[model samples]
Target: MALPKEYVNQMRELLGEEAEDFLASYAEPKKTAIRLNGLKIESTGFGEKEAVDKPSAGQSFVAGRDPVPWAAGAYYTDKTERPGKHPYYYAGLYYIQEPSAMLPAELLDPQPGQRVLDLCAAPGGKSTQLAAKLRGTGLLVTNDLATERTKALAKNIERAGIGCAVVTNESPAKLAAAFGATFDRVLVDAPCSGEGMFRKDEDMVRQWDADAPARYAAMQDEIMLEAAKMVAPGGRLAYSTCTFSPVENEGTIARFLAAHPDFEIVATESPAAWGFAPGRPEWLTPEEAAALGPDRTARLADTIRLWPHRVRGEGHFAALLERAAPSGMAVSGASPESEPAGAAAAESRKAGGKTGGASFKDPKPGKRTTAVRRGAEAAGRGRSKGFDDRTGGESDTIARYEAFLRESLPGWKPPGTIRIKGDHVYAVSEPAGSMQGLRLVREGWLLGLSTRHRFEPSQALAMGLKPHQAALSLQLAGESEDAIRYLKGETLQPEPAKVTGLNGEPADKRGWTLVCLDGCPLGWGRWDGATLKNELLPGWRQV
Candidate 1:
């Protein structure tokens, strides 16, 4: 690989005597790894008591390997392993991600039931990690400004069986204005000149230019300001990038700290333990450092750097910043009254039962209802698709949905505000109408489609459900022909005896079924006494 002279010169000044090792490290192979989806395994008690350390299904593939040090349930794999082709991968049991990229979400450490946001989330690796930490207990508003990019973002969230996430395609400024200081944790995985990924993706190297760092730094600073607005008082914000540029890393944090006095860089866990180095304040231009002042620039060392030469992964930089709160004001979530528009009354009326299964009550006429009607119209489908624009109102829709829940899930009660938009149904974790005008990719967990008198469950609904949650389920082994055929969208004639009830006894075998692979829920199926019809989403079918 021919290194760019300007980039080489910059690295030499940045690394000093370590430049040779940094340059030599590019020749090494890229690292490969996967994180087991606890949302899938733990909910079902699939393999072992502790699925994080010992994933029984993929043990043979990743056994005897030390897990990624900083990330739990993440295991390094050889490039030839091809875990993506396995049935479990289709089952949404794990996510494939590069090692260093996992650190930012871990640093943010969002807890269950706290509102979190991923500002630049797309193709959602970090967003899913945050969802796993939330454990379906909180709202995760994952957004990407790129409209086209949101397709992949929403797909990944659905594939992971994450019920609490709301995917959006909107600008950082719009999101900040809408949410206010509402989130407990916010992540800005800012875009930059892809210097860190050059070894893995040759296109990044081809796209690089000497002026990339300063250009990207300006955008990163702007993104950080918006991200700061969404974080609640006393909340934390985590900034990360896959570049080694000092202007984009320490300089960005220094500029932010100097501008926002309420925020400070908190030291992370020991940097040596993770093979991470301290942030380089010396790399900044003297003029830049002087403008930032001595104290602010000196605090930049609390940030982290994961050099390719020093770690087993690509180049990455991360910093954790906290917003100080006034006395008695460190709330984790914003009250409904504080939400934009008349969302407070919408929240009061939209309060729902477990599994979002309660009766639906429409909010009073005005902006909130108008927003709901507009969203529903935007998502409306014609009657040829089996949908009906009945004037029976939200109550009737909830009635049909409840019928399906009674027959299929039995007594399961998941949390979230239920939303009935045209023919589609969703269980949004955020308060109703809170995200009204944003360009929403998904309001929340898409329960299914409501067609005429029937409520059809979605592929997303299946991924999040446990074996026992469904009244009937079909369990298949990972290597079984039945599993592969099921993933391939092929109808099957499994013996009626193979079908089991919620109690594991011979079931009726004549209705909706939760399909599973080694006890992990895959998707939904409809089983008759003689044959099982495939209900897997066409887009997710195995090719």
Candidate 2:
């Protein structure tokens, strides 16, 4: 495994006596890990109570775990275990991630009920982590500039049972313009030269060039500037990268600090305490250091680096940044520019009384031409009443939706406005106008579809609910034949006793049933006296 000579030389110059060990560490097996989803499980010991049904001793998905020390709920798993193939994986019990990649979101520490953003959130690992911290309490607006990557991003959000997410596919500049310092916390996990990943992915080594860092540094700086604009006053921002490049890490911070006077780097505990190394201001060239000046250069040490040789995982870098609060403002209080919680009270600037804040403006002209024009007010008021006669779909669309909720999900109300767009129904957090003019992927939580006369609940809705949340539920042992059959999209003929209703209601063996694997909601099924028809999303069905 030959590294780029230029890169080796550079590392040697920067790491000195540590360079040999750092380069040799690449030959070792890459670490594999998973972060347990808090939205899905209560604690690390969740499977212990259900241990009786195990196919064999220690057969639980989390039976034996080697936890990642720096991150709670994250554990190191071996590659041979193939955790991805487990039924629990389909149930969204955990997320497969590199241990080092988990640090940024852990450091950002988004709280419940605070609006958060993952600016470069493609493939959504960090975004999902932040959403778990929110615990279904606040809005999570995750965006990626690449139009195609958002498909996976949306799937991951839904899979994790996250209901308060708004998925967007747009440029950072456009989002900054529309949101305007509205988020309580922001994460810009900037794309880099993949220098840090060279050990884990040989492809990155093949693709490396001498100029990669400088090229990516320019983009990272620009992205940071736009991301800075979206942070609320006194809000926190985290910048991170997978590359060990000084130009992309410390250099980018130095440049950003020089430009943005209202922001400062918050000091953190000693990096070694968390199996990390402090940022190296000494790595920057003399000219680069002079450009940053003495004060900011010294402050750069507050950032952290996770080296492949020093940590149990791959290499990564992360820095916490905070925007200064206005004079006399409390850190926890909302700033004047901040959008209020629920944001339903804010009047739309659009004419003729639209809700949210603006009409859906397609980022591209002539695309989404048939986009529905309902406001958040319609979703919040008319639809929730189960009689939204205004949107002009089928006359009984809302009636059907209401009936489903009452019968299947008796006590659970979709958190946001129930907006009907075409045949699709969404429980949207912000009014349609709030995201006006941005390219939208998913408006909010996709509740289901409103067909001609019936409301078909979506796989997303099923994944987002718990077993008790539904009126009727079918619980399958994680290793039972029934579980795999259901996951394969096969119908089942179960004993009437297997079907149970919420709060002592009689199990009639009819209507929609939330299907689960070991009490973890997998999807939905409809039981018709004799057979349980699988309603699992076809795309999600195990092959």
Candidate 3:
């Protein structure tokens, strides 16, 4: 791939002698990875939020190795390992992300119970990590300017079993005005000139020009102004970018600190401590510092940058800033002492933990998992596609949903408080903002659908459940042909004697059961006499 001349020139100056080494990194294959979902894992039975070190499904899930240095529970997978094609991916066991892309969220270090926000979340890599950091204890509101992208963000969050999040499609200015220093931790993974993505996405090279960085720098300033407003006093605001441009990385931070003196750059966990380099304020000329002041340039050293040559990933930059002035918008999460891991969460990530996927243990069908058909005005279809349009939360809908829950889940209490919209039902774990006009992609835990006549659970809801949680369940072993068949949306017969069937025998009755691979719930499926119908979503099917 030919390097963009302007981009190369800019990086050449920014990197000095190291520029050659940095540019040469593009020749090496990029590192691929997945961060485990801490929230989706089993918690300590001792009534605390700490997750167990191992998965109940066993160790076959984490069969591969090479852990990322920043994101905890994240490991570099083989480049060809298309986890998206696996049942565990649909089960929300982990999120596939570029290694350097995981650094900023790790540096943010959100605790289990604090209110947080991701100012520019889309395709949800960082937001999911934030959800894992929160461990289902606090509110996390993630936003993107475009409503279309928020759909993917919402799915990734829900798929990862996060119920405390509210995904929104709105501008930073509107959110800042509405929130007003409300978050304990705020992340701005600003969109940049794609200098870092040239290798991974060749189109970025076609789009790049000398003018792109300056254009992005201007936009970053506008977005940063609003992001700063939403930071609570004493709260931390983490800013990051994938571009190597000084104008966007250092210059933008310099301008923000100068614009808001009450906000100061605080030293974040440095990958440099592990051999990566820090951000260079010296890259900015004296003229640039004139606007941000002289000290602003010196403080830039506090920020960190991940170079592709230095690390086994693409370029990325991160800066941690604290709002020193009291704005009263500060919300508290878990005390710092109780946070699960440090900014460099990799050091503390649990190693050798098992994962959920392809279960073979056929549930002993003792109880029937049938929801009674309720009479109502509209026997409608829920947002099975995941981009909700606010239609289901009526009183009748709630009642019907509860009835279904009782039948399907039995004694399992929902993780969040229930609320309905259209045919959709949600279990909200934290207090949500009014967000009246903003396009809210997801408000809480999307439990399932409840039309006038039928009630159906969601793929997202299935991922979080255990085999025992459902009234009926089918478990499969890891790497089994049956497991692959089930994930491929193929129906298969179960050995009648292996799993005790409901109503006397396997051929005697029919109902819905949670389909599992090992102990991980794949999704919902229906059984009819001799065969189990695949309920795995078409888009998510392995085949």
Candidate 4:
């Protein structure tokens, strides 16, 4: 794989003394990593039954052998193993990720019970991490301008069993208009020139050019400005890129700070711990950014730079920022004297700021808002065209669905509002006030769909369930050949002796069955007395 000459020339100039090492690092094999679902950790509760941390401890996904220094429950998977092909992959156990790509979410550091947003979440790697950090307590809105791409985002979020997030397919401006200053922390993993992707994908090298950086930098400028608006006054926004172009990195950060001094670059957990380099402010020349002043250089230095030569993974850049105004940390309906928890509240306390003191407060669930979005409001209050929010659907859909939840998931309780749109049913994490205008592809958890006679659980719902919650469950070993067949949507015919009723007595009776590998669901199946019919979604079938 040859590096582009102009790109090489540009990097040579930027790297100064380290250009040779930078180029040489590409010859080495790229590293592979996976992050276990922290929501599955022992005490974290997304389900009635806790997901065990280690396979030896209980029925859960196996943690990788070596831990990545910067992320908890994240590890460097063996290069020899096909981690993506493993049965646990279908079980929402872990996410395959590029090691350095994990940095932005870590720096953003979302906490439990705070309102958060991922401004450009797609393919949902970072969004899943943010969801795990939220621990199913706070509201997480994952939005992207590309409407089609959010499907992938929604699927991954579902596979991970992230219940707190509301996935939207709206542009940054519309999102800001609908949710101004409501997010406690917002992440803008801005779209970039893909120079950092050259290592893993040679195609990106073929497409590189001198002009692409400037084009993307201009795009980032608009998105960051809008994203900044969504962050609560006391909230923080994390801007990151997978590219090394100063135009998209320091130059963009410098320009934004110039336009909004009310927001300042702040320190994130030290990047040095993972061999990450610091941002080069000098890389941004006056010609590149007219508004950039002297102080911009010093402030931009706070941003993190992960270079291939300096780190074990592909290159990346990040800048953590905080807004100056005071904002509340408590959820709406909590007392004025109530205190907030997590990073946002801690930072507010450190700054001696008051919560809800400046324009931002907890959002009330299930209401309409025009002035500003409350940080506490759960997503999906938008009224879609086909569904009746009043009746929960065409005919008693909410009632039938709620009854299904009661029967299917014993002891299951609605975390927040449950709304139905068309045939789709959503379990909202926060109050979804009037989202009449925004293009919301998904809000809260996609519980399933409502039909005339009964409600069917989504694959997402099955993935989110505890093994025991299902009426019928089959926990196969991770390496079991049946596990492989199960992922392929193949039927399993266990010995008649082992075939027992869902209640663990005699053989017979069943509807939907939850298939699992070590107690985590692979997908849903049906029991027709003789065979366990695989209901795994076609797209998820193992090739």
- What TM-score does candidate 3 reach? 0.84
User: Model 3, which residues run further than 4 Å from truth?
Assistant: 41-58, 61-64, 271-273, 325-396, 497-510
Sequence-dependent TM-score of model 4: 0.82
* lDDT tens digits, residue span 1-543, model 4: 688889889889988889999989889888778876755533222112333453242223332255566665566777798988876676777899998888888777765666788989998999988876665666788888887798788878878877777888999898888877777779999999988898789989888888999999999999998988787766778899999999999999988988897887775445465587888888877754557667656778778898888777888998888777633333332222223324333332221221111111112211111222223211222222223224445467777777776655666565666666667777776543346698878766666666556666777777666665665666677668888888887888755434344565544556667777665677777776668888777767788
Candidate models: Cα lDDT each? 0.74, 0.74, 0.69, 0.70
- TM-score per candidate, chains pooled: 0.87, 0.86, 0.84, 0.82
lDDT of 1 by residue, 45-161 (tens): 332332565555544544565467666567777878887898878877788998889888888876555678899999899988777665556578889999889888888887887
User: Which has the higher TM-score value, candidate number 1 or candidate number 4?
Assistant: 1
Candidate 2 is scored at a TM of 0.86
Candidate 2 C-alpha lDDT tens digits along 443-477: 77777766655787877888788788888988788
Ranking by TM-score: 1, 2, 3, 4
Indicate the worst ten consecutive residues by lDDT in candidate 4. 353-362
User: Candidate 3: global Cα-lDDT?
Assistant: 0.69
Best by TM-score: 1
